[model samples]
Target: MSDAPEDLDAWVVTLADTLGLGADEHPIGLLLDLTRDAAHGVTRPAGPLTTYLVGLAVAQGMTVEDAAARTRATIAEWKTEPSEPA
Candidate 1:
């Protein structure tokens, strides 16, 4: 296995191909930004949970791009709202 960290995209593509999933159709940068927004604007666990919801939406026949767009919009709205102190 290659030890280069820059090869993460290649590794992700390979894993997606192995699983017969369509990762190449989506923009990695956008996904990362959405995840970052979810984590920071909402909560740490929200990042993965948001992504998981996007996946579920896609599985239910929504386009991946649309799901990402919706998730980002939701995060934007979350950022505008005030959060209660933990």
Candidate 2:
């Protein structure tokens, strides 16, 4: 089944707020950037809104594997060094 629109919208909003940016910005992208830029692995209290987004995604017919894969891709993007323009 396709993912629920409500769940996706809410997730984006919460993520945007957490990053102090507009919802138009990609939260997953920001998260990956933050994690990659951090000197050490960091863990902070997950905003209640973020927790809700995760649960919402699961309920919206997203498999854990699907969610995990997206997360991994975002992280991998961050791990790669940005190429400088020649």
Candidate 3:
């Protein structure tokens, strides 16, 4: 229900801080912004596109190990290259 973009941004920043990810510069800040968008219902249809998914999951009360595993699975799905059956 927190769809306001500004609120999303703030939430993301605070999350980054809580995780010690520190959204004060490039890369990390951008990723945090992306996570905020996800929480606000924005999504990349193909799948999770960044570590933001991991961070956001952690922020959502998921256990660290569970979030890490889910994040890894999402990343693997995104990175899987199409293969031709030999």
* Best by the lDDT measure: 1
How well does each candidate superpose onto the true structure, as a TM-score?
0.72, 0.32, 0.35
In terms of lDDT, model 2 sits at 0.51
Query: Model 1: residues >4 Å from true position, as ranges?
Result: 1-6, 82-86
**Residue by residue across 1-86, what tens digits does model 3's lDDT show?**
77786787787688769979777633444455445444333345423444545656666898656765565454445446533447
By lDDT, the better pick of 1 and 3 is 1
Per-residue CA lDDT of model 1 for 5-83, tens digit only, reads: 4586788788788889866654667667778889998989999888878878988999878998888877787789855
Tell me the lDDT of model 2 at 79.
50
Off by over 4 Å in 3: 26-46, 49-81, 84-86
Worst 10 residues of 1 by lDDT: 22-31
Error of 3 at 25 (Å): 4.0
Q: Which TM-score value belongs to model 2? A: 0.32
